[model samples]
Structures are given as structure tokens and as C-alpha cells.
Target chain A: MPRQIRRWGPPLLLISPSLIIIGVFVYGLIAININTSMTDIHTAAQATGRKPSEFVGLVNYTDLLASPAFQHSLRNLVLYTVVFLVGTMVMGFVWAWLLDRPARGEGIFRSVYLFPMAVSFIASGVVWRWLLNSNQGENASGLNRLFQILGVPFLQNNWWNNVNYGIAAIAIPAIWQLSGYVMALFLAGFRGIPEELREAGRIDGASEWKLYRYVLFPQLSPVALSAVVIIGHMSLKAFDLIMSISKPANYQTKVPAVDMYVFKSAFNYADAAAVGVILLVIVAILIVPYLVHTARAEKS
Target chain B: MRRMAAVAAVAAVTLGLAACSSGGDDEATSTSTGTEAGSGGDVEVFTWWAAGSEKLGLDALVGVFETQHPEYTFVNGAVAGGAGSAAKDLLQSRLQANDPPDTFQAHAGKELTDYIDAGQLEDVSALYDDYDLTDVFPPTLLDLLTVDGMIYSIPSNIHRSNMVWANPAVLTEAGLDPAATYDSIEAWFPALDAVQATGKTALSVATTWTQVNLLETILMSDLGPESYNGLWDGTTDWSSTEVTAALTDFEKLMSYTNTDRDGLDWPEATQLVIDGGAAFNVMGDWAVAAFEEQDKVAGTDYIYFPVPGSADLFGFLADSFTLPVGAPNPDGAKAWLDTVGSLEGQTAFNQAKGSIPARTDADPADFSEYQQSAIKAYAQDTIVPSLAHGAAASITVLTAISDATSKFTTGASDLATYQSELAAAAGS
Candidate 1:
């Protein structure tokens, strides 16, 4: 105990600077945002003078909850999150499994699969925006054009412009970009599983499919869970991808992050802050429980 | 590969910094970057036209303005955005921070209300008399800029919003005459059908603000000038069948638009019309400059007419400048304003801007055939303010209306619901 006490001071000193920085930049800003949201400040109020906003308790939150725009955005965020997470996970696992085998050019295929990860989401978004454009016939030069060349007119849907599948369409580019990273995660997890486990399954007369279904998949759940956490938070705070890919005021693709931006520009400071807080609460709902379970699992 | 991702991350930070660099919340207006405002050494003229002919137009004006005042430096601090959204945001932040530029561009009417109510703009009513601008500018245009018996901004130029640019050859191919004009909104249906039969998208529009342009034109055609003007204040009832009819026509208009429009901007939409991929585009007269820049001759490569049934009305919006309150150099700002609202400034700026000079006295020969027609139309037709471009309504109201229009254009909302939502927006 005495030795542990003596060792603590240097470690404490080592972490203090980052702690202070995070405290000021992240937590301090968050608190200020929350305080700002609990008021009646708006564009008109702010323009007259940046006054100390009169406290209005939960009025901003109440108004946001009642607003159709906010409700629509929340719905989009949920839909976008589900499709992105599942799409990335499935694509990642498939890519990992294909490349995990002993094959000639495995290194080349692996590099090719990982290339999209190198490009930023915004960069991918701009390119995909054109490729997925809903223009028809000669004007269409992207995915729709390929469909035309393939003689499969049925495959030529309005990609992202179709609002019913708009959120899902956004997920396609996202999955394309992040699935390679997810594959890296799964590949690591696959490598971490000792040969003995597979050998035991093989000794039991289990085929590769059976081994994958029962043994391999169950063991990768932890890695999958971690990937979900990473991707989940990303989808919650999604701004740049949507901004680059879609129209700014496109209600079909609007999410809370975009709502925050639109509101901020209009000088509806209180509403903007409310959107920020709602985003925080959602991220917390998704991540806090996963973090707690992971901590407990590590301890156990 | 890692370097590329790092660059993307940096790009995101650069955008954030640009937003914050609206001069921050320090409340310090003075900077050493330009010549001191108090010294009469520099008069920073702010605008959103940092590139293309818009910039060229501003440079032309600056060239003229500089010749008039050799003692002062004219800093062209133009931030660029598709519309004025980016510049507006930057200007808003700077104004809030109390670091007003000596002069800034704004839409003349309701758009300047935020700055005025916030006490960011100085009343330049006296400059109107001193410069004899009351004689040069039309009373209708002057009336739009006046708020509570005081004029807040000096309009440099006027651009009619309800202009329809067409590819003459494409229309001729469709068996429609190159110079044809529809007498009503419903008349466009047969025309668009003919264009579509020729295997072209009948109409072209861009993503956000362009939808606003289309919506405003549709409203004016259906509602006429007096009722259309009533749509802004509490004078017209949005729940009336007239608005419902306008929304219906708006929906019909969207049916003819290019499906890939959400991926394009206004210029691209104009190019679509020019390239014969689309037959028609409802845009501001600025599309003339864009077409001219591409070496497309007017009346042959392309033709423009006011949107069907709206020829009797000049749906106008003005790009004007304001002498911001607490300007570092009031004399320099007054000089700039005098130049902006003056005959020489308006003529030079408008000739390059593809807009008609706000002053009626500008010689028509100095403008293009298209712009001369616009000037003649401005003189003969009844003037109505534009809702889409922030002339008829406040930004808050305009934003709400835009949201409804955007949603409706995307087929996210039906006509009746959009009508009610618009009513709620205007009433708010």
C-alpha cells in the first residue's frame, strides 16, 4: 500500500494536463450549452444585443419536442444509425472472411478492400453523390447509367432522392467507406482466436460452415460489440457526410446534427443548444451502457 | 493513405475555423490588417461575390469608386456562398461581435431588418437627398428599402427573379417556337409535355434556394401582383384557395424538373437548359451572365422570358449596401454609399452583374439586349417584392417558407399540409 501510494504522484502528474484540457474544452462547453438551452434566446433576441437570456426552464426542449422538424430529424438519425451499423458489420465480416483465407494475391485484395478507408467520408460523399444521381437516360452518367448499360432498367432507382430509402441510401456510401476498417477489426479478432478451437471443431466432424456458425461467430461478438459502439457514435454525430452528399435543407435526409447547424445559422441559439443536448442524451443512451458492460467484463 | 485522411480531418477543421473566424466574441472591432478606418486610408466593402462575373462587377465598381476617392483604399472583403448564406453568417457574427465592416451588401428590404432591429445599420436617408437618389431610383424600389420612415440601405442593382431561360434550339426541336410565352401557369403543362415528348427534361432547378425561386414565381403567376405582395405580411391568407392553387402548380412544376436537381446548383441547372438536356429553367436574370460567360449568344443559343402569366409584374430583388452603425469611417462609408446608389456606380456594377441598374436614368444602350428588356419590364410592369430572396419577408419567415417549399419539392409533404405550414410560418 505504501509503495502504491508512492507511485501514484508521478502518474497523477502525467494525466493532469489532458484532464484539465478535456475539462475545459469538452465538459465546460457542454455545461455552457445546457445552460444556454434552458432559456428563451432566439435570432431576434440575440440581434438586439447578446443579452443574458432569461431562464425559461425546459421551454426550448418542450418546443423542440413539439416541432415537426426536430421529430423528423430524430427519426432519420435512428433509421440512419440502424442501417449503417448493420450494413458495415455484415460487409466487414464478409470482406474479412474472404481475405482471411490462404490465397494468392490476398495481400493485393486486402489493400484494395482497405483503399476506401483512406478516403474521407466527405470525399467519398461528393463522388457518390454524382454516381448515385437520379438523372435518367443520356443525362445519367453514374449508377443509373451502369444500370442502363446492363439492360436492367428496374435496377435504376432514384438512389438517394427516393425519400423512403433515402436514409438507407446514405448508409451505402458510409458502409462502403467504413467496412474496410471493420474488416481490419474482425481480421484481428479472427487471428486472436487460437487454432485449437477450430481444430477441436474439426475433430468433432464439423464442417467449416458449422465451425463458423457455432464457434467463430460467437467468439467475435465482443469485437462486433466494439465496432457497433464506434459506428453508433459516428452515426449519431453525422454532419459532414450528409452535408457533402445531400442538399442542406433536404428534409428527407435531415438529422439532428444538421438541425444544429441550420438553427445555429438562423441564430436560434437556444434551439440549437437544445438539439445539441438531445444529441448528447442519445449518444449517452447508446454508449454509456456499452461502456459499463465492457468495464465490468474486463474486471470479471 | 493516412495523409489523405489527415487532410480530410483538417478540411473539416478549416470549415469550423471559418465559421468561428467571423471575428469571434471578443467585441474588438479594430484590426491592423487593413488601413485604419479612422485615418480614411481604407474603406472595406464587404460582399458575397468573391468570384466570377460578380467579382468582376464589384472590381469594376471599385475601379470607378477608387478613381473618385484616391485618398482611400477599397478593400474588397467578399466571402463567397452560392446564395449569400455563408456571407450572411459571417456578416452576422461580425456584426454581433461589434466589428462592423465600413459597408456591407444586403438584400434591401426585410433582409436588412435583422441588422436594423439589432441596431447594426445606420439610417442613410439623408444620403438619398444629398446624392439626389430620390430622383434616380424608382419610388416602388425605394419604398421596399424604407422601414418606419427611414431608408436603411442603398440598392446598387435590381435583378428580377421570375425569369425563365430556355434553350431556343431545344424548344424549336420540341415544335414550340423559340420566342413563345405562355399566358398562364396551366399553359406550361402543354409546353412541358411537348418538351418531354422531344426526350428532354422540361424544367431544371437546383437543390435549395432555386426551389424558392420556382415557388415564388408560381405564387406570383397564380396570385397576381397585389395578392402576391399580400403573401408576405398579414394581408393575404395562405389558407385561401389561391395559395392552394399555387402549391398545386408548384407541384406540377417539380414534375417537369430534372430528377438529379438535388445534386446540382443554380449554375448547373442553367447549364442543363443551355446544353439542351433541359428545355426551361426559372432563374434570376443572373443566368444571362452565366450563359454569356460560356460564350452562348443570347436570342440564338438561349432565350429568356418572364415566367408564364407573370409578364405584367416585375418580381424583383435588389442587392444593396448598408452603412453599418458605428462604422469606423462614417465619411468613407457615406462616400461608398453615395457611389453605390449613384448613377455611375449602379450602371457599372449592374452591367457586369447581369442585373438592371437600380437607377432608372442609366442609359439602356450600356446594358445587354436581355438586361435592356429587363430594365424596360421594370419600368412598365408593377413591382412586387420577392419572398425567396429576402425582399418581402424576414429571414426567419423566409427560412420557414423555404423549409416548407423544400419539403414540398422533395415530395415529403402534400399541397394542403404545405399550405397550412406556410400559413403558420408567415403568421409566426
Candidate 2:
């Protein structure tokens, strides 16, 4: 027992502080949130008082699933996730490819591309709101004005005001903000590949496109996957950007996160918690496989 | 020996973290308890008047508060957001945590019903008697303030929501009378058509809430004051033919508004009237300040009237303060409420806020030309709560109504669907 303690005690002691903090703040709060989601606590009055709320077990979930607004938000999430993931990865890869070889002013170009990532979504959202202002004709402004100046008035369509796919328009800003970070990831992935792999591809009489397709792109899948996961979860949890660009009541860009905020503001805590749990499950559905794959890779 | 030393080091670090966290807990507890023990300490008055003329009004009120209650320090806990949405969210969390401010801003009428039902506010009916407010404030105003014979808040200022602001230039360019008053919404449609004929937006509107604001006025105009009030108290049926007519009228009015109605805010829409891009805007009395900001003269540069068909009715929403149930300093809060209801405080606050004093007895000479008219109107007009500004319904119901209105205005839902959604919201 003494020998075992000597081997394990130091590491366990070292990790205990983080374990306790995470256990209480993270896992414990999630448990509380799940408990609250099952209860019929809708008002601040019910939430604060000594009397416990009645457990209505999954009623809140059933109600949320039935709600048109919640369903609309889910649809928005799927659309946003797809657009944001694809846009970011493609843009990131293009920039990474452009800078793969050493060139003059390459660092400057990279910094210019990456600088948007440093700005908070709220700050950038305010600017993008003006840039994407949907007013046309005499009231035209922002990018619409630019289109008019360029004599391409046809391009001055409502950006995020298109009812059917406005959430997809919102993904434009999300893509602009994160593609730079993805570019960095892809660049690092490129740097990590051995030079001999490219030489071997070239020696095999492969064209440039074939060399990239066979040798480079396959090796970069891990980086692309990482970018997708990161951007995927972000799109799932998007709030402030959408809020700053539009409003909570704005149906065109409303998401589940915004709905959660609205529900909480109305003191409908159970509904808010249900929305929160749904979002958590959605994110888990996305992340769990990646985590499992990483774990297995590490084990092998 | 070294391994044992490493284990002790790790244990010490873990103990330090635990100690740090516990220390934070102790500090938080001590501070909270200290605030709870407050007698004549800080009087934190929470509000959303963190910028613009609203902040100026708050400052003016704080000045009155300091003069009357020098024993207490006024803590400005104003959170900035358009329409107090952000502030209300923060206030809810604080209320849930049992850490309410000494006093907080709330709308008078049905908005207070939720807080009253939750037992989150204390009845300040005695304060009204002590201050002789019953004699000072109009009976109509007092009726709106009271719930089940108890008043929970003191009205600071009243904003008239059923006002139409028109640019004389735009009206003249459209060959319509700017100062002309329409007896009903039907009488007003031709004027909107005339402006539209001149290739201008007949009506300027902004966002979902503004549309809801317009809808409320139309409802008031069509149903009359009693039925309008009944809409909140469960007396009037939302599915009735009268309501359907009102919703139809609302849709007709929406057709005359700007194409980008959902993209702009109240100020921007009002600016359309100010700049003569649109002939008229239906906005609250706060637009008076917006016009004044642009150096526009009332009655010449701009013309004002009660919204068509809402002539004898005041579509009203008042900003009021409350004595929260677990307030740290109840006496201090009472002092604040006293000042809020006091003539000097109301005058100072209203003059700066571009709103009329809620009190009936305020001197007319102290106000502007438009406010003088509003003050007279308030005494004579039947005051009905403004739905868009949190006076007609609970927040949840109001949110539901707004959501339904948003869908209808966006063309996503039809009038029948809109009315049913509204009925469902009110029923819920």
C-alpha cells in the first residue's frame, strides 16, 4: 500500500485542485441545470424561494420540442453549422495554400487574414451590422452603397433579411471571424508533414494537383476536422454576434441560444434550461465522436 | 524522500486553491450580509437610463433625491440597453438571488402585476397617502397604478405612446395637410395614400415592437377605451369581430410603412419624419426630444396630434420605481419613491425626459409647448396602458404578443394566425 501510494499520490494530489474545481463548477452545475430542466420552475419567484418546484419530468423538453420557435431555432442551427464549417475550412485552406511556400510579405498577408480573429464577435458584429444593413433603393447604405458605386446594383439584395436563409447570411460574419484561426491550424499541419512525402509524389510523375490531392490533402484531414469541430460547436452556441447584428425578436437570425436568453428573460427558467440542455446534447453529439476518435488514436 | 516531498508540495498547492476559493466565499458572504444590514447606507436605484436623455432624467431625479434624503448615498446602477431589455434580465437574476437593489425601475400597470404576484415588491399605498399623491395625481393615473387596492410603485413620468409626428414639408409636398386631424384610422388611410402617391413612404415604422405599438393604438382607436382596457383584464375577446377588424386595420397600416421597417429602430424611423423622407411616424412623446435634437420647431418644422381615432384616449406607459421586498434599505427606497412621486422630482425628470409629469397638478409653465398639451390631454383623456411599453401585459405575455406581431408583420403568418396566436398568448 505504501509503495502504491508513493507511485500515485503525487500525481493525484497535483490534479486534485483542478478536479475539485471542475467537479463543482462544471459537472455539478450541469447536474443542477438538468434537475432544473425537469422541474416546473418557470418564474423567478419559484426559482428563489424555499419551496422546491414540482418535478414535471421531461414536460419542459416535450413542450420545447413542440414549440415552433424552438424548432425554427434548431433549423437555424443546422443551417448555420453547415455554412460556417464549410466556409471557414475552404477559406482557411486557400489562405494556407497561398502561404505554404516562403515568400515576401507572406507574414504581413497572414497577419491581415488573422487579425479579425482577435476582435470579439460583439465588436465585429456591430461593424458587420452596418456592412450588412438591408435597406435598398434611396435608403441604401453599407455594402449596398458599395454595390451601387460599383454600378452592380443587382448585388444590393437584403443580406440577413431574406427570411428563408437569413441564418446562412449570418454565417458570413462567423466565417470571416474564424477562418483565420483555421488557416493557422492548416498551416501548422502543412509544416508538420515531411518534405520527403512531396518529393516522393513528384518522383512518381505526379502532377501538382495530383501531388496535393494524394500527398498533402489527406495528411491535412486532421487539421480540417479540428477546424470543423471548433467552428461547429461555436455555430451551435452562437449568441452575441447574432444579437449585436440583429435582435432577440428578429426571426430571420434567431437561434436557440437567443431563444434561451429570451426564455430566461421572461422568467421561464425551465424552458430556458431545456433549450440549454438541448444545445448541450447537440454539441455533445458533435464532439463525442471526435473525442472518442482522439482517445482511440492516442491508445493505438 | 524526494517523492514524499513532491506529494507534500502538491498537497500544499491544492490546499492553497481551496483556501483561496473559501476566502472568496467568505468575502462574498460578508459583503452581502453587510448590505442586508444597511440602515442609512447606499440607496442603489437600478434603472436602464444609462445613456442619452434618459440618463439626464435619472440624473435630475437623483439630484432631487439627494436634496430630500441627504442621509443616504445614491448609487447609480443604470444598465444601458434600448428599452431596458438587458437591465431587466440582470434585475431578474438579482431578484432570484435575493439580492435586489434598494429600488428598481419598472413600468406602472400590468407590468407590476408579475412582481406583485411573485411577492417581489412591497405595497407602497401608504406612501401615496403620506405624500398626498391621491390628491395630486389624476384618478385615471391612480387607477392604473393600483392592483387589488394596493399600489406597488410610484409613477415617475408618463409617456404618451399614441402620438403621430409629421414633417410639414413632407405633408405639403404630398399636398396633404400636416396639421389635419383624422377622426378614425379609416379617415387617415387617404392621407397615407396621398403621401404614397407622391412617391414617399406614407408611414415610418421600426422593428417588431414599434409595429406592436402601432397595433395597440389601432386597437384602442377601433375598440374604444373600455374595450381596449378589457383586452388585458380578460373582458374583451381577442377573437371577436372587432379585434379582427382592428388586426385588418393594423395590416393595412403596415402596408404604408417603409420597406425596411424591421431593420430600423424607433429613432431611425422617427428620423425619417424629421428629414421628410416619410410623411408621418407613430411614436411616443420621446420623439419630441429627437425632433428637438435636430433643431426642428414643433407645429412648423413638425406637427403633432393624437394618433387618429385615439383623440380622447391617452395610450400611456409610465416609468415607475418600486420598493423591492428584500431591499437592503427600505427607508432609503421609500425616500426615493417619495421623491419620485414628488412634484419637483416629476417636473425635473419629465422636463429632461421629454415626458409629461404623471401628477395632475404640475405647473404647465414648467413644460414645453407639446408637454403642456400632453398635460391637459392626460387630465381629460381616458388613460389606457401601452402594450408595447410593458404597461398592458406581463413580460411573458408581452413577449408572446410581440413574437406573434413580428410573424404577422414579416408576412410569415396571416391575420387569422396572428389573432389566434395572440389569443393563445393571452390565454397562456
Candidate 3:
């Protein structure tokens, strides 16, 4: 064998299994979901050999578009995505910057920030629900308990009813769970910058702000993009937190995943599938371009 | 390297073939033995009761089944999603993969109808015949389990869905009679409201299926059972004034429920009534099992009645198990089904489940007072087909109602919109 070919062959062979695993588990499932969405197959129908394999030509899509629940969920998903993306990225970057500075108990602070992410979403959701329970009026769950203990009665009202503040209430858990991941990503990106680059900028009369704006910010793009993509995906598929917060009776907490579940249970699998397909499409539209670009960048 | 690649490809092909063969064997093993193979002779029964006293009732049932079939064990596939959302989908995917449990719980009627039609269910009609189920089983229970005149499942018990469970203490505190007919239940709503004013929940409607159940009760009681049954199997105008009135009344009733009720499961709502946390809980007869767990005696601690002030029509459905086509132990499954369906089995299972036996011959004395009352309604022919919600329509139709109801109760949608959406779903 030629030397160049011989050198790369073993590495390629070694990685093949992992590639196959990814192909079957990740990409394959996505393809299956997409294909199923094109048909009208539901749990019952699928059970009965009545699975609609023939193409219905976007009937499901049209139905989805006309669904008010779907529309509301889409709006919620977009709002969640934007809030989650902005909150995590900005807060995470800020925390990352703060942690990057020399300080006491940096390790403890880092661990504190990262601890929320370490816990399972299920556990986090339960804890958050207990903390956010509306019954805890002035002394009940969430900020109320904290406020009431401080003799601040005004802070104890139903936070869920305040449309203006409810999104923020819901967002708190998302940020709590996600900012750490973002911070970690940003930390890695920040640390990648050579100390000499900062020193050179400093020696050239660049202030701290200016050094970051031009040098640091641009270098963090890839990391921020990565964070945005991941957090956005997580936010889009967010189920547990919203469910924990929003009782079915409260019009405030209804999200797409909850609705998907209700629809699925009610045996409205078509509607559920439609919701799922729309979610999948939304995520793909959000992330695929970045993924392709990243892959191309890596290849080059 | 090319040779190695070729060898690796061969290995892949071989392993793939092996996987396919193993899967085929696994399926054969499961399918051939039928229902006998429940989670490795440890029948992993999947249910939605993980809270409070339903858990106790389940424990009792498990104990009975275990004692009856010691060779078979039980695995708790008890998932905790209210309304059986997660577990049902999981069951569906498993059944689709032809890896269904030897036995799993199902609501008798259209829920199992799809499985029956798919030939995924073993008929077990002969088991019913052998069990001499006619004596103990009522025609209504049989009606729910039979599709195309063939019984596809064996119901463990009958749950009278129209029962309005009331706290006698709360009722007396409000100076209201607990034994009032369905029509009287609404009159008692003011009394319930009084209870609510006392800083307790007046009505424990969980604002999901419970709300739907309450609505069904109103329809059955006020609109008359004939018209209610017409809504399901017969032609009735859904937009009629009766439905409109029933829905409006239901809306008003919902106003009395706990603001946090939407997140509450039915059992939690029942717990409220049992704990004197709520005045009334309109749930199924099986709900008595919850109160019983607190050692509260029926007809004493709580008063059960049909939707009060309305007709005496009883709305009922059955909880049944279907033997999946590929159950690993079909013989054991058949044995399980035969044992469960027999007059003796029905008596034993129903007694534990706080449900009336599916068979007509199962001693009425074997049930609790609430169940005895339900059986009386059935005996008097007051028990109508429950198709209005549970038994009335196919699962597809029931789901449509549930979804529309969920949205409607949440105030995300309203009545006219609900009706139209329901119509669309039914037509779909």
C-alpha cells in the first residue's frame, strides 16, 4: 500500500463502528420520524395494519398549520428559544468572564453554577415545581416564600397569572439548568485565547473592553453558535419544566410537548405526529445550517 | 486494509443476520406462548396508578394474581403520567414491534378493538365460554368486550363512571341531602360552594378527564340517558339545545373547582374528597377503592350516588386485559384469562378492585355498598352503555373528546369551538 493511504486506513477503520452507531441511532431515527410524518399512521392504525404508507402530500402539514394549539405552541417554542438562547449565552458568557478572573473560591463557584445541569431534568423539574407551586401564596412556593420570610407580602401573589412575569418565571428554571452548559462552553472558548494575544493588545493601548470586543468576542462566535444551537434545541423540545409549572387548568403553562402528550393519550396520534414533525422541522431549520458549516469548517 | 474492510463487512453482515435471527426467535417465543409470557413469567403489568390508595388496590390485585400463578411474577410497569399518556404510547410501540406483554390493562371497547382487528389480540372468546361467564357477567360488560360478536378481552371489573362520591360530613354541614338524584347534585353545588367558602375545595374536579366525566354525568342525568346514548351510537344533534345547556351548566360547575385542579390527577381529586379537602368528587365506582384505603366505609364515611337530580341511568365501562398476539406464554395467558373471567375469578378480582364483577353470577354481596348500588342500577336496566365517554365511542372518538375537553376546560378553547373540533375529529 502507498504510505499516505496506509497511514489513514487504520484510523478510518477504528472509527467506523462509531460512525455506524451514529448512523443507526441518530440520523436513522430522524429519517424515520420525517418519513412517518408524511403518512397518517397513528398508534392504533399502525397496530391494525392500517398504517398509511402512501404519501398524503402534506395533508398533515396543512392540518398542523390550521391547529390553534399548534400555532400557540410554535409561538411558545420560538419565545422559549429566544429567551433561552439570549439568557444562557449572555449570562453564561458573563459568568465565564467573571470566573476567568482570579478570585477566591473559583472552584466552588464553578461547581455551584454547574450543579444544576448535573441533576436530571426530571429531578430539577420536580424541585422547581415544588418551589414554584402557586398554592404557596405569600409564604408558598418560589419567590413568595423567599419574600414572605423577609416580610415582603407583595411578592407572594400568583406568579403564574402575571403574563408579564410568567415567562420569566418559567425561564428561571431553563436558565438555571442551561447557563452552566453555556458557561462551560464559553469558558473553553475563552481559555483557548492565548495570553500573549491579550498582552499584545494591552501593550498596544487596547483597554479591557476593546480587547474583548475585537479579539475575544470574534473568537467566541463558534462557541456562542454552538451554545445557541444546543440550548435552542433543548428549549424547543422542553417538556418537563413547563409541565411541572403549568397545571393543565392554568392556561399559562400549556406548551407543545404537553399538548403533544395530551393529544397522544387522547389517541389523536395524527395531531401529535404533526406537532412532532413541526418541532423536528423547527429544530432542523435552526441547527442544520450551523451543523453543515461546522462540519465543513472541521473538514477544511 | 481493503481486505480488512472486506472482513469487517462480512462480520457486519453476519452479525446483522444473527440479530435478525435472534429477533425472529424472540418474537416466535413471545408470540407462540401468547399471554403466558408476561415480562418473563414476571408479567410486567403497565398501569397509571402510582399514587395513594389505587396503589393499595393494585397491590391487592397483584397479590391475588401472584398467589394464583406463583410461577409467574409481576413487574411494576407502573408509569406515573396522569391519563395514561406515557404508558399507552410505550405499550403501542412495543405492540407495534410485536413485543407486547402477555397481558396489559385496557379499557374494554374500541381501545382493544384495533388490536383485535389487527389480529394482534387472541380472541379468548372460548375462554369466556369455558368460564361460564354469562351467569356472573352482565350483558353490558360483554357488550364492551365483544367486537363483531367475538370477545377480545376479559374485564377485571366494571367501574360505574357516573357515581358522584360525596363527603356526608360536608353534605350535612351544608344541610344538603347526599342521596339526591343526578338533578339534585347541581342543587347541592351551592352547598358545595358553601363548603368552598369555608376555605376548602368545594368540588374536586381535576379539570381533565374528571371534568369530562362530570360533563358526561350532566348529559346522562339532565338530557336523559336515551339522548345521551343517542349521542354515541344513535343520531342526535350535538349542537342541540340540550347539549348546549348541559355544557353551560358544566361550565358553571367548573367555576367551583379548585383553581389548581387542572394539574391534579383524578386520584388526587378523590383524595381531596376522602381527606375532607374537597366536598364532592364525581368519579367512577372504582374510586371507592381510594376511600377504602383510608379505612373509610362506603355508605357511612362517604355517600355515593348517580349524578344527582338527574335520571337514574348508570354509565359504566369495564377494565379489561387483552392477550397480545405475540405473548410469549399464550397458554399461560389463556390460563390467566380463563381464571380471571370465571365467576369465581370475577368475584375475587372485582372485590379487590372495588368494582362490580363482569359476570352476572358473581355474588353482589362480594362487592362494596357502592358497587352493590351500581349492580342494582344494572339489574334494574338503569345502566346504559357508557359510550358517551369511555364505552360510547371508539378510542379515536374518545380521544377527540378528551383533547377537546382538555382544551375547553383549560379555557384555551370554548364550547362551540369544542363541538366543532370534536366533530372534525370524529369525522376524521
**Can you tell me which runs of candidate 1 are displaced by over 4 Å?**
A1-16, A47-53, A137-139, A200-210, A213-215, A297-300, B1-37, B326-330
Q: Residues B275-294, candidate 3: write the lDDT tens digits.
A: 77778888877687778778
**Which is the winner by DockQ between candidate 1 and candidate 3?**
3
- Compose the digit string of candidate 3's lDDT tens values, residues A3-117: 9779987887897777666655565555556666676665565534555445565798897788676676666666767777788888898999999887899889988999989
Question: Model 1: per-residue lDDT, tens digit, B1-428?
Answer: 95685446545554555456555643345443233455456788889989888888898899788877777778888998647778888988887667788899998899887777777888889999999989888888888888999999888889899999999888888999887778999988998999988889899999878898898998999999888888876798999988888888888889888888887889989999888889999999888888988899988898888999998999989888889876777778888887887778888888887888988899999988998899899988999998878899988788788788778877888888899999998986
lDDT, residue B158, model 3:
70
Q: Candidates' DockQ values? A: 0.33, 0.36, 0.35
True contacts kept of 1: 0.51
- lDDT per residue for candidate 2 within B318-408, as digits (tens), equals 9999999878788888888889999999999998888999888899999999999999999888989999998988888998998888777
Candidate 1 or 2, higher TM-score? 2
Pairwise lDDT winner, candidates 1 and 3: 1
Superposed on all Cα atoms, model 2 deviates from the true structure by an RMSD in Å of 3.8
Candidate 3's displacement at residue A79, Å, is 1.7
Q: What share of the true interface contacts does each candidate keep?
A: 0.51, 0.29, 0.25
TM-score of chain B of 1: 0.91
lDDT of 1 at B121: 80
Query: TM-scores of all models?
Result: 0.91, 0.94, 0.84
Candidates 2 and 3 compared by DockQ, better number: 2
